[model samples]
Target: MPVLIPTLVFRPVSTQLLVTDGVRSVGENIRDALRTHQDTKTLGCHVHEPIRPYWPEDAAAQSDRIFTGRYNGRRFALNVTGGTTLMALGARRAAAEHNVPLLYVDTDNGVIITLAPDGSVTGEREITVSVPTSTYLAAHSATVSAREPWGKAIERRESWLKPFLEAATVLGQAGGGSERLLDVIRPVCSGGAAGPAELPEVTTAEESLANRLQEFGMIEVARRGGSLQVQPKGDERIRQFLTGHWLELYVYRACLTSGLFDDVCLSVDIRRRTESGTVVNECDVLTTLRGRLAVISCKTARLDHKDENKGAVYELDSLLQAELMGLYARKVLVTNRLALRPPLRNRAGLSQIECIWGPHLPDVAQRIQSCLLPGRR
Candidate 1:
């Protein structure tokens, strides 16, 4: 049998590591990760250590050592699923030197990629690995306890929000008619206030539009004294549907519809300890494609703030968090606002973040697909 050599890296999950057929690991972290996930049960597990992952020479030396001894005569394939860039570079050198094939798992596209010894793409073969959601979440260090199954949650939300989202789009376009109705209901839906005593009188034309919103089950009209009372459904679902969470759900649905990702997580709560204390970072959406990570931040509110520096600061902080996830992970901001001020845009450019906004919001799946195309990022 051909021997598979893989470099080890720090990972919260072992989906990628387990899916790739290999025996190579250069660190205790990866070895433990694989063992905890039970990947070592089916795949060959070879653990070696004391090699520097960030030094190309050290990584290359480790690869050389693995190739020596009893394993010398077997054909070798380098699987660069884990490890640092230095380790990848060193492994690439080793592969080229031995004229062996290089393999990589593209998690996003669910494909096994083959590269010639010279680092040229040779082929891509699709794969199906049965990885449970709980296993995947555990690998990523996410708190799976008390968390709803993402697929079930998504299915429930999609059914509940379909008509609500359609109404929102119409309200977005209908201007004052929509605005007035929202004003009458916002207090009831957002705050714990009772329904408004009376809605502002509407023109005959606007009255029909208001009736349509009621017909859509977005609100209920009741008579109070000598006037019409407007009461929006104040359930938690409605509150979330009306807020930024709606946009987050929209983006998540779009990603699901596109079918371009290997795995997707919505509202992933990641906790990490800092010098001060433990902090929780909630990502709107996290996706893996073609073995790269994509961190998407969805904003329904305006991107521009009166305080010029505020928006830039927020985007910068988000970008920094994405960088911490992985070196080559894509950082993206998706917003329904028309545009961000030039400063914020410039900051995004400087940080290598892809901003999708305005009209592009409707075509989010296509836009994200474009970003994931080979040679784009």
Candidate 2:
């Protein structure tokens, strides 16, 4: 009997019944994202969709039909966290009838609350599942194209990365020099570098910008009397950075070095196709912290109209749309070399957007890191 033996290991199978509504792709996208999740893939478990967007009575009936059909014997839990109020009401009816546990997600606090089948709170559970950036986007029915060249090089280019951060610091400390420099140099460097004869005469603030970058070895500058000359060094990337690309890199590098985020992307192009046409949303920096989505917008040039910063504020606030990234996303607007006055701050605050401006922008990396330490959060 001890000569030979055969063994088998069987893991429990987990299944989910997703409830969607007539709203849009919100429910479909969530189901699709979950179907593509790492666990469901590895375990070879299948995702089945039997219920579609329907009225309250139809929704409850469909749920009941499925429960009494093939999945009758399987243990179940109902998540009433999302979907339309009617859909939730129908799901609640089915849950009560089927005697399944109910759940509500507390997104801000990062926990899932359990409830009795009748819908009263029972207890809370931590969010254990991990969601990737792509999955998060897919959950919102948005897809991300390839990232910019700067993104691929973020973690690999420490030598260049360090200097860029240092230069950004100098930009903030140099008073209004950073903006003047970006505004002037961006156009000159964008379509290839312009001839020296075509360079604009430097204003006092602009001249300070040129001088500070010179000290950081980013460029060589010569001033004769009141005339200013800028000789950009290094590769074409250097010129690209001067053309408002540096601010993106600055904010990205700060997030990357903070080590607080699990995934960091720089200059992501988000596209969503609709009946009208394809819409594009260009983001400066996109990251995820504890499975939550964050969109950071960087501004090197003034985008205000009539000295009102509402233009920039609205652009950042638009990410909350359901067709875009959704309301759960964290929005941040970081301005380099320019101070965000009280009006801008108050406007951003109203939208729950974090505004990091001027010199304060330079300390973001440290701030994020500090929150990671024990008792700091």
Candidate 3:
């Protein structure tokens, strides 16, 4: 039977230490460990030629043995310098080249050491000693402390698993409108991080759940300023929201309609008085028929999925918004998304406001045509 090889792990202390101070500090830590446990005797460490005989000239030299330290009869090897760029690669290369007993690796420190048959490192390199596989294994094991050598590995695995559950919760809470999902995602989406190419692994499930919320409609995503935005293939509202050039289309369609005016002009900030005695400044889709002025206020909402009552809430808000619109002018809400409010089901009789709902282009164009028909006036 083949012997099951013990997995090698790099200690987090050394990993963090290496990132902060290079490999030299890791070597020192190993040396301290040896002196605390090993008996008294002569100590020597075989380090890369660049590390030996430290001098000012050697400061810029690639010191291969930044972590090599002598402590009692045992020797500790730490690789500090060359690890800046080619870290584990350098150590692995060194092991392959030399027939020494391979052991623990301090990937952060960039150190490789030879060991004896019994997995002990005496005072010398592998040249004179009969290096054993166990020795290499021991060296590898030494890089991690016995306290919790596997902690980082477990943490890494956990980091990758959190996103799924979080995504499900965020999506379920969405109430079925893409726009609501976008609203939740907008606050969290940093154009800096969520690129199309690489979404990062989130630490907690909640963070992952937020990312899942990102795959909503383009108009909603665009409204929120997200980088990884997507929309339905025929979603024209997304096109209008992104381009900001569709107000003219709304104005032109209103001209031939009879609902309120004959002479139509898009008002920038037309003011009107409401039934509740509040004055509101609004954009007026205006027209003059029989020398009377009429107005329409446009309010739009993209969809947000998961909140079934989202439409009802939106309908209520739209009514309130229309009352605000009615304060100064008649109101019309043109939305590509399905009408969320049940009370506003038919545009035929909803107080004094009109709700236009259509999905595809022809349907939307017709709805706009219906809202703007001059006969209604």
Residue-wise C-alpha lDDT for candidate 2, range 1-377, written one tens digit per residue: 00000000112253344444343455456555545555443432233444565567766886687678766888766666555678678878998999987777765555667899988899976643445566677667677754556654663564665676677656645534466556655655665557342235667877777777888776777776667777776567777677667777776767777667756778777876566997888887777654466677777776454354787788877766644666456777777746666777778888777767676766765544333222221
- What are the lDDT scores of the predictions, listed in order? 0.56, 0.63, 0.32
Candidate ranking (lDDT, best to worst): 2, 1, 3
Q: Pick the candidate with the highest TM-score.
A: 2
Better of 2 and 3 by lDDT: 2
Summed backbone clashes in each candidate are: 6, 0, 48
- Per-residue accuracy of model 1 over 1-377 as CA lDDT, tens digit each: 00111222212122122211122322323334344444443434445545565678876766776656446767777777656778789877876776768788664454678899898999987644333223333334333221243334654664655676566555434432333444455566767577552565555544565566678775667644444576666567665555446566667777776787766667666554344776566667766554455668876554566564356346536644542343435778876665567877877777777888765776776677666554554
Off by over 4 Å in 1: 1-41, 45-47, 52-61, 70-72, 79-152, 155-188, 192-213, 220-231, 272-279, 306-316, 319-323
TM-score, one value per model: 0.63, 0.73, 0.27
TM-score, candidate 1, is: 0.63
Q: So what's the TM-score on candidate 3?
A: 0.27
lDDT of 3 at 92: 34
Q: Distance from true position, residue 80, model 1, in Å? A: 7.6
Provide the RMSD of all predictions against the true structure, rounded to 1 decimal: 7.3, 8.2, 29.9
